[model samples]
Structures are given as structure tokens and as C-alpha cells.
Target: MAVSLGVFSGMRFVAAQPHSGNLLRSVTMAVHVPRKGLGKPGRLLVTSATVSETPSSPKVRGIMKPRKISTEMQAICGVDEISRTQALKQIWAYIKENNLQDPENKKIIICDEKLKKIFAERDQVGMLEIAGLISPHFLK
Candidate 1:
């Protein structure tokens, strides 16, 4: 593996190109860096960057379809019924529509009633804190 350092959009990442003796197999790389509030580190070496063998599952980008919510989730989310995915979508939509997102930082979400319930009555909450708030409302 050729370990090369690359900078994209001011962010640093390690890029590796796979090699077999003298031949270039395929470009396989992994992102190794930590963003704020990501809560964990990302992988370093991407063993397989290029897919040359039989087809594997295709990669899907963008927001995932909201999962159907149980009855309990609706009460906490301040809605009658919703999917976990959908509820998040609505929450996000509300955040965007009302411009409740913090101006200083995009990751910091300013809370209103919709987000307040999701935040469990907290005066303020970070985007990273969202998971912790949602976990309680979800059924085991």
C-alpha cells in the first residue's frame, strides 16, 4: 500500500493506493481523521477500496429512509404516529424551516418545542447529544 497524505477542503486524510508487486490493482483507501463530536475515530487503512470481484451491495448515500416508529416514539416526539426515521426527518425539517439551527455553528441545533421534546426539556443541546435524547423514547 502506498501511504500518501492528502488534503481536501482543508481536511487532512490518509490515502493509500493498492499495489501487487509492480502492478496497480485498484484504488482502495480509507478516511482516517476525527471530526468534532463524531464520538469515535474513523478507520485508517481501507483494505478494499475498489470492487473488482463479484457484485456486492451498492452504496447508498444521503439520508436513509425513516424507520417506522412505535406508539411510544410518537408521544415523546410530540406527534401522533411516526417512524424513527420520519420523526428525525420532521425534526430536521422543523429545525431548518424555523432556522433554529445555530448560526455560529451548523452542528449546534437551537431548540424549539419539536426539538425541545426530542431534547427532553433541555435548555440547549448539541447535535451529538441528539442520539442520547432519542434513545430513551425508543422501545427496546
Candidate 2:
């Protein structure tokens, strides 16, 4: 193995290229020095500096994945399908626009006529209850 060291942009880089005795199968790897407050002490990051592998698109799973929504959810999100994160964003936008949050306790939501439709006609709901209350609106 052959090793080389160099510095770029105030960061030190160490390259190691494996030497083959018979066949030519050399792969160069770079040793990455940890940045300030990145990782624990005495830790190093390594990567293939010479390789340029195209990254595959990330999979959409969990709450980020869009799914079919009920009519009541559609009414608030303005879309027939949406991700939980996006749905929450739309609901928060509606709440902020209409000033539905209680003035005395900001965490308390005073459901108006529009929110009541989705909140199962509940007169008021807590901030934490929003996620649970809206879950049914997302069709399985």
C-alpha cells in the first residue's frame, strides 16, 4: 500500500492506493479528518476520493412518503394525496391564517367551523393532539 498526504482548504487529506503484486487492481481511498465539533475525539472519516459513484435517489418512506388522504384532509391540504409532514404544514398554515390558536394559551387550538369538519366536530384541541386527531384523515 502506498500512502500520500496533502492539505486542501485547511483540511488534511491522506490518500492510500493499494498496490497489487500481479494484477492491476489499485483503488485509491482518502482519509478524511474530522471537522470542528463533527465527531468524537480520535475519530477519522474515510472515503474513495478517486471514485465518482453516482448516488441513487433516496427512497420515500415513513411520514415523508405521500399517501392517499380522505376528503376532510383534502379539504384542508387542498390535495387528494400528501405526506404527513406536508399535511401538518398545510394545517399549520390554515391555523396561522385564521388565528385559530387560543390567545390565552397558544398551545390550545380553538377549532373553528372549518377545522371542526376534520377534527370530528371537537370544539377545542391541544397542540399535541393535532397529530393524533389528523391521523384518521389519512386513509390507509
Candidate 3:
């Protein structure tokens, strides 16, 4: 079996086990060090290693779960309750259906009659701003 590990500082280490009856036998290891000078190439060094257990997966903390959409958003999305992801998907569907994207710059969404009400009467809005604009319609 082979295992690999990497560090953010651009160092990579790999360990491989050979087919042998003894588990504590010498293992093959390689270390890759990045070049320091500009346009220079890196180097790989091979060595031997001892036996050890594999590292476990890191634990993820403080993940925020999806919440239900607000009443106004629900009305706009035509659903009683929906996730934020689903709300965005529905809004994109509506935009595509109405050809609301600006022909000159696709990032700009040209608001139509129905979208004007949701977009605060703006004739055009950036695609990235759509989330912030619709944030007020969502429930806390």
C-alpha cells in the first residue's frame, strides 16, 4: 500500500510498502522539495522509513446548515418553504426563461417587468448583487 501527504509550504512526502511477510520491514519514502529560484525545477529525494499508522481525516467544525427561506422569498419562488440553494436555482431559471441576462455583458441582469418589483425598480443589476438584493426577502 502507498500513502501520500502534503504540506501547505509546498512539500510533499510519499511512503510505500513492499510486499513482504514482515509488516515492520523498511518502507520506501520520497520527499519532493520545491525550487527556490525563479524558473528553476524541483527535486525528488528517496529514502527509507519505519512502519507507522495512517493519519485520520481531519474534523470539520462550525458548519452552518441550510435554513428555510422567508415568506417573501417563498412567494417569489412560488414555494411555501425552500432552501437558499433552491431559491437561487429557481431565480436563475426565471432569468434564463425571460432572457434577463444582458447581451453586452452576461454578468449584468436586465430586469423585466416582473423582476423590477423584486429588484427595487432597477433596470439592470449585477449578477453578484442578486444575493444581497434578495437577502431582505429572506427570513432571518
Candidate 4:
């Protein structure tokens, strides 16, 4: 049996198993890497049989946007200009080094006076919510 993806003209076929009446249907699609200017037309084929070898993606290029840390938070979490990802890494490291994670539930982090002030008086908060609260302290 052949299955077609309604969105695109892609088709996939499933082979029958021995002594099995049912015909398993599978759908596989091929990716097309279009050639750039001055390049020959690219070929397309199903990728269900094997993985394609692709070069590593180029590094992202952009300005290092400056993030401002709140005056109070700056005193606690020392950092220069940092992206959101880097800020999270440093915060998590600080929490772990000081054993601030809740013993019963690691998702819940116990805050000291420093964190409490940054977190707006919450004794304990979930890890996900920390991102929102801390983001305000970072100014782009």
C-alpha cells in the first residue's frame, strides 16, 4: 500500500510481513536542497533507506546585544553582556553551588534574601518561572 501526504506529492510504501494479511503503510518524504546561482539542478530522492550526510551549520552572525542587569541583581549575579541562554547557565550554576534546590522536588528552588528580592518575595519558585522574573532584570 502507498500512502500520500495530502499537503505534498510525497508517497511512502510499506512492505508486507511474512504470513501477515495486513499491509502496513508508511509515509516517507525527501528533502530538496536547492542549488544556488551558477550551480546545477539538484536531485531529489526518498530518504527512508538511509540518512543523508550534511555539513555542520554555519555559526550564527550578529551583534552581541548588551543586557542590563538590575542594580540589586548585579550585586548578586555578576555578569557582563549576556544572552538569555548564558544568563540561565550562570544562574543555575549559582543555585547548585549553594545547594538552593529543594531536596524533595528539584524543580522547586528555595530562594535566599538575594533571590527573594529579585523574585519579588516568593519563598520558593519553579525553575521555568525564574526565566520571566529574571528577564526583567536584563535590559536589551
Candidate 5:
């Protein structure tokens, strides 16, 4: 038996699978790739069959999970508790809002008095160092 949906007009014959794994296991997509010499790229039908290839996403955990933050962190993020991801976003927003980036290199942040409190009193901090610098501010 074949199933058809109004939207998926081209996908007329999709074999119904009882397995509760990936719903797109039977669905294949044709992609067109441009080659150096070929006028028309060869059509390839690719199907994601394994759960590992199209697994259902789980809830957020670890640093992504919300947790209580220190007073210094709260001062920057304006929240008593926040996720590591949100904290980083807020810090970056503050940096951009205050125009705190270095004149010569954009990757280096020029810390003002407010930023100095959370950033360990450093006059300058590298963009990559932001993650590590804020790790200590997240309370256990």
C-alpha cells in the first residue's frame, strides 16, 4: 500500500513502516550537484535510514541547562539564574552595546569598568577566552 499527502505530491509511493524510529527512513531526496565538466549534475537519491543519522533531539543539559549564577554574572546578564549559553549571549550583547571591541583587532574586547568586574579586572580579553572566563561565575 502507498500513502500520499497533498503537500508531498511527488513523493507518491512511500512504504509505510511500523518502526517508531526515523519517520523519513523511506523518504529520499534528490539533490542536484554541479560538476566541472557535466552540463547537468547526476541525480542522487539519498535516504536517512538510521536513527543515528536522524535521531530525535533530547532536552538541554550540562552548561546549556539553566542554573543559579553568581552576583557578578547576574550583574551582567540581569538575571539571578541563567544558562551558560544565555550568559554568553548577554555578555556579547553588552560588549556590542558598549562598543567595547578593540580598535585594531575585533576579536579582542576592551573591558570597561563594568566589564572589568566580571572579566577579572583585565583591560583586554580575547573573544575565545569569554567562555572560560565566565565558567567560574556559574554557581554550583
Candidate 6:
């Protein structure tokens, strides 16, 4: 049987059981090439040794600290201090709670009375533009 692992950290792993001598071997290969407009380049690391142990769980990275929400946003989000992610989550929850999604086009959010104040009195706004629209409601 042949087993192939998907890409991880830009590397691929392939394990095959060969009929010759009934041998099993695993091969890991990767190539690192920097691309224009991409982030920093990374080095290629390869190891031939095989261990029967499973890989360790990836570390959980810390998120950005909560920031003070502007007075206008605080009223909308019902929180004085909130992270950008949290604020967005609250806004999404509010929209869902009120069923603000357009019946015809789900991509559009119909601004309610409360949302109208935060959305600059716009009757309708695109879902993708929510982040940009709420940006001004966050304090630096």
C-alpha cells in the first residue's frame, strides 16, 4: 500500500511499501523558492531518520491584545474594550440576531436602526465591506 501525506510547511511526505524484500520506506522532500511580493524567504530542512512517534501539536500563538473601542463602537458592540476579531464577531452576531441579511442577496446586509448609526446611515452594505466600515470605530 502507498501512503502520501499532504503538504506541510511547504514539504511533502510519501511512504511506500515495496514488494522487493517487503521493505517499507518514507521519503520527505521540499523546495524553498522566494517569490516576489511574498513574505520573508524560508530555508529548506530535510531529515532522513524516521521516528515511530507522532508529531507534536502546534503551539497556540497569542492574539493581539484587546484595544479600547471608540465610544460609537462601544455602544454598537456593547463592550468598552475589545479586540478587532472580537468586535467583528459581535457585529456578525448582531446582524444574525436581527436577520439583517438580504433575502434576495445574502452577500448584502440590510442596516437596521442601530446599525444605521454605525454604518453612516447606509440602508444597505456589502458583507465584505463590514471590516472597512467598522475600522473608523476603533481607537488607535
Which candidate number has the best lDDT? Answer: 2
| Runs of candidate 3 exceeding 4 Å displacement | 1-72
Ranking by TM-score: 2, 5, 6, 4, 3, 1
lDDT string, candidate 2, 1-140, tens digits: 65556756535565444444533344455666777787787886665456333345778999999999988788888989999999999999999999999999999999997799888899999989999888888888
Ranking by lDDT: 2, 5, 6, 3, 4, 1
**Model 2 bad stretches (over 4 Å):** 1-54
Can you write out model 3's per-residue Cα lDDT over 3-90, one digit (the tens) per residue? 7865435555666766666545445455646556733475554444456644455543322324556555565588765666667888
lDDT of each: 0.59, 0.80, 0.68, 0.65, 0.74, 0.71
Between candidates 3 and 6, name the one with more favorable TM-score: 6
Q: Tens-digit lDDT track for model 5 on 1-140?
A: 23432224222223333455546444433223334465444553333322223546878899789999888878889999899999999999999998999888999999998788888999999999999988888888
Q: Output the number of the TM-score-best candidate.
A: 2
Clashing residue pairs found in predicted model 1: 28-49, 66-85, 67-85, 69-83
Each prediction's TM-score against the native? 0.42, 0.64, 0.49, 0.52, 0.62, 0.54
Which residue runs does candidate 5 get wrong by more than 4 Å?
1-58
Better of 1 and 6 by TM-score: 6
Using TM-score as the measure, name the better of candidate 2 and candidate 5: 2
For candidate 4, the TM-score is 0.52
Candidate 5 lDDT trough over 10 residues, lowest sum? 5-14
Residue ranges of candidate 6 with Cα displaced over 4 Å: 1-63
Q: Over 4 Å off in model 4, which ranges?
A: 1-64
lDDT of 4 at 24: 32
Per-residue CA lDDT of candidate 1, range 21-76, in tens? 63554454544455556545454433334534323465543334233444545654
